[model samples]
Structures are given as C-alpha cells and as structure tokens.
Target: MRRYPEIGKFTLKVYYEKDPEVRADIQKSIAKYADFKQNVKQLNFDSSQFVPGIDIEMMYNDMYWASEGYIWEKIQDEKYDVDMMERDFLKMVDFWKSIYLRKEGEHDEGN
Candidate 1:
C-alpha cells in the first residue's frame, strides 16, 4: 500500500449558495475550528474524496478565487458571506483534520 504524505495543511471549500451572507457564515464556522488563514496553505479539491450532496466543483472554484489573498481577505471579499461560509468551512476542516490525525498514527486503546 502506498502511504500518503502527512496532511501538513488543508483547504476547505463550501458548495452551498453563492450568496455572500451564507458564505460568511460558513467561513466563520470554519475559522472557529481550523485557522483557514494559518492552517490551510493551499486550497484544492479532490472529487473522489468530496462529501456527498456537496458541490465539489463550486467549492474548488471558491478556493481558487480565495487563493489570491490571505484568509482575511477572502473572508472580507464581497463575493462571499463570512458567517455562513465559516460554518461549512469549519466542518470541512474538522473532517480533514480527522483524516490527517488518523493517518498520522493509530489511536492507542488506552490513552
């Protein structure tokens, strides 16, 4: 079996509505968990790993757009709503973190 590189960084894309308000929410939520600005060095999408019901294409597009500037800039941009975007972003971050943690080491039965 091939070993994947340790997930040193991650980027999350939320594919819900294009509305700025909703996007903001998602961004805020993500910030609460993952430091989108600090933790995520780059944002890209893999269709094979994307969650069901989420539009991976749209998320990828948003990430590409946000990549132009730092996390704060992306959140402040009128293109998306920080609060709503945070929610989805955070969830995605959490999921990614979980996978990263799992791959790093197996949980000890007694810890």
Candidate 2:
C-alpha cells in the first residue's frame, strides 16, 4: 500500500486537461448519476476524518475516456472498513510502481 505524508487537513487534488467538449460530457454524465450542476468543475465529499472514512475527488479530461482522478484519506483504526483504505493504498502504490517499473525496464505485467 502507498502512503503520502499527512497534510493536517484532508485535501484531494484532481488535474485534467482544459477541454470544453470533454468537460461538458463529464458534467452531463455526473448530472445523470447524481444531482450535480453543469458548471460544477470540482466536487468534494466531506466526511469524518477519523479512521475508516473515505473522501472522493474526481476530474475529467477532454481526450480521455476515463476521467483522471484521485482520493485521499486519513486511516486511523481497523474498526471500520479498512479494506477500502487498503484498496486506495494499493491504487496509489500501483500508480507509482508502474511508473518506476516502466522506467527501470521491468515488466509492467499488464499494468
């Protein structure tokens, strides 16, 4: 699992290319799934910072079918669904692992 240095307050950052068509499509899709505004460029879910909590951040890219994204959380205890935390941790690990492996001539293994 991957861990980032704690930043005091929980914050999620999503980055995407600036594209109008792609941005519009993402807005429409999110609106269809939930009550979201068309102009909403960013979304934040505020939840308890205690252990076993999740925070989601989403971003859209004009040229990519899957939106680029990230999630950040502070895990404290195992009383909650720590599996979710582990999953997120693995995702973060996989991201950097892939990059490093690629640069080091190691097999990406279908990554």
Candidate 3:
C-alpha cells in the first residue's frame, strides 16, 4: 500500500494452528509475505500490482470474495438456495471472465 504507514496491515488468515508440531510443520505454508520477506525472501504485496476490474466501482454488487456464507461452520448460514446458488455461480463465472487476463489477440471485453 502507498500509505501502509497510515493504514496498518489487515491480514486475513484462514488456516489451522493447533499445536507446536503444527506450527513447526506448517510455518512455511502459513507465513505471511511480511514475515517471509523479513526472514526468507524480500517480496511485498505492493498495491500497484493489483489491477482491479473496471466494474470494481460496483464491486458491492458481486460477492467474489464472500468467504462467510460458503464455509462450513458450527452453525449453517447459507445465503442462497440451490437454484439461486446455481444462478450466482454462473454470474461468478461471468464476473471472472469479464476481468481475466486477455490473450495476445483478445480485445477489450466487459468488466
């Protein structure tokens, strides 16, 4: 981020850390970019590298990063029924296709 100093890191961690053995075994897999950069590789998740979709202005209209309602938990909370989920799945496909990297001969498409 250009202003990481102003906005501290908001890391989204989604994994298990049960015990010391797990920590030792999965340290490499779970390591964040910052920790890896500090200890192993000097790489960063620079904000400039991420090119958001043109439709990002209406990003709220879609749920490409909706991790909540899709996961299995102690209590079930499915936001979409089977048919609705099917339709949303198609929309999700279209959304990804709209912004995916275009090939050499490909022209601009919807985003």
Candidate 4:
C-alpha cells in the first residue's frame, strides 16, 4: 500500500457588493496580506513552501457595469461576449494577483 503525506489546506470565501469601490477595497485587503506575508518571511519562517494557498471568488453584481464603453468593439474585435467579459476580466485580475504573491514568496525563499 502506498501512503500520501497529509497536506495543509485553507479555504476562504469573501463576498461583497460588486461595485468597483468594493472591489478596490478587496484588492487593498489582499495587498495588506501580501505585506504581512513579506514581513513574516523577513522574520525568518523562511520555508520554501511558506506560500499560502489562496483562492477567491467574487459574486457577479448585475448592478455594476464593468465595461462602460467599447462594448461593441470588444465583442467584434476581441470576440468578448458582453455578458461575461467584465466579470471574467476582474476574476482574472484577482487570480493573477494571487499568483504574483505566491511567486513573491517563492522568490523570498530563494526557491
């Protein structure tokens, strides 16, 4: 029989109004977490695997207009479906930010 080592996992869900201001606020919170994580490493808990696994999903707010203008242009040129484009783009932004933080931690560990 093969055995697998237990792995740590954390799951978090943050739901808030879909306004740009709200999203901006969430972004700020994530930035703060990034700063905290950096500080922790500086104090030397410096394990190569110290990067925390983070996942966030934002509920789509119909009231918020993500793309104001160029809607048609986006649909025609970029083939972005008007209905899903904005929300998808924002989710992608959040995903990338998490990736950046993870890589930053990895860099701090010299791994």
Candidate 5:
C-alpha cells in the first residue's frame, strides 16, 4: 500500500508471486478494495478525504500465465466459476468493515 501526497492518490500494488494461492489472495484483496471503495462512493462519502480511493493494480509473471490448474487462471476465463472470487471479496469487505466500525466506535447494523 502506498500514498502519494503530491498527487493526492492512494494505490496498492501486488508483485507477481510463484505460489498460485498467494496470487489468488492478492486478487481477492484487490477485489475487496474495489468493492469497499464503491460502497463508500454509494454512501455519498468523500473518498478523496474519508477514504481517498485506492488504485489497485496487479502484476503477473510468466509462471502464472503458464499455469493450467490454478484458480486464478480459471477466474480469467469467462466460463469459470466466479462464486469463489465474490465470496472472498465479500468476506474481506466484512472483515474490514468490522475493523473500521470498531475504530470509529460506530454500530455495524447497516454496514
């Protein structure tokens, strides 16, 4: 995670990993971040101040591209099962929301 003051931007970059599981986790995190940012936007919140929306970008190596049995690879295909990805993203978002609510001393009813 990195924040640039000059540009008033936040970004998260994940380096390519040899382990398929790790890569998948990184992808899930990115998805969660995107969902959380969108939810924030929908709430009419100022992301540039309250959240300062993050740009999540991923890097993949040749090894990942060559994989035939990896879940990440399956996710890239249009016909693949996407429930796993959605579940992971939602789970991550829930966990983060819990933490944020705790920090802010707010109830998690609507969140």
Candidate 6:
C-alpha cells in the first residue's frame, strides 16, 4: 500500500540482450514505454500484494525478461513468462491488457 515504494523505483534491473537487433528492439520498447513503465513503477503499491513472498525485484525483472523473451524463444512474435508463481505487476498488466483486448473485440463484434 502506501508503505511500499514505487514499482519503477524497485529497480528490476532487467538486462538487454547483446545482439544489436534484439537490443535495438528492446531499446525501442523501453523508449516507447518509458513513461508508461515509469508511471507504473512510481505507483506506491505493495509488490507483495500481487507477487509472492519472494524477492520483489527479482520477480519484477523476471516478468520483464519473460515478457520480452521472444529472441530466445525463436518467437519472431510477441513475448511474455518466468520462474515466479505469485502474481506481479506485469501479470496484472497482462490481465488488464487481456480485458482491454477482449472488450475491444466485443465492441467490434457489436458494431
């Protein structure tokens, strides 16, 4: 809650791949979502509320890695997983994104 630090300031310290192409893409995302990410990070919510009792920073970083792991996955598509079980901010974000997409689809159908 109010006692917790902002999520962005949590310093997930996610690392970018050394490959130029991958690094570039990640950078682009980082830039495009800088404000969004920063704002999310700044929210004074307890990381524990969503994520498990594990190290919050590790879990947050894991979410970022998993979400952006398309390169290692040979995905050539979207990225998104990781080793943590407890729900985290990214999980909530993904959940919300799903809702938004679902609603959008519904609206399209309605139209």
Top candidate when judged by lDDT against the true structure:
1
Error of 3 at 57 (Å): 23
Per-model lDDT: 0.47, 0.36, 0.40, 0.40, 0.41, 0.45
What does candidate 4's lDDT look like per residue over 31-84, in tens digits? 643443344555453234324543211111111233323343453443344346
Candidate 5: segments with Cα more than 4 A from true spot: 1-43, 46-80, 103-111
Clashes of each: 25, 0, 0, 0, 1, 4
Deviation from native of the Cα of residue 67 in model 2, angstroms: 23
Candidate number with greatest TM-score: 6
What's the lDDT for residue 53 in model 6? 39
Candidate 5 lDDT, tens digit per residue, 2-107?
1332231111113334578778887776564345345445556433322222332111122223332354454345354346655755775565445332344434
Q: Could you give candidate 2's per-residue lDDT for residues 2-103 as a string of tens digits?
A: 243233122221112147766676566555434334333444432222112211222222212222222222323313344565686577666644432234
Give the better candidate number (2 or 5) by TM-score.
5
Off by over 4 Å in 4: 1-73, 77-83, 103-107
Mind giving the per-residue lDDT tens digits that candidate 1 earns over 9-102?
A: 1122342335798888877765533443453345443434444444544554455444434344554443554456567667766765454333
Model 3: lDDT of residue 36: 26
TM-score, candidate number 3:
0.28
The TM-scores, one per candidate, come to 0.25, 0.23, 0.28, 0.22, 0.27, 0.31
What tens-digit string does per-residue lDDT give for candidate 3 at 13-51? 223344677566566675552142353234333322224
lDDT (Cα, 0-100) at 47 in candidate 6: 49
Taking all chains together, the TM-score of candidate 2 against the true structure is 0.23
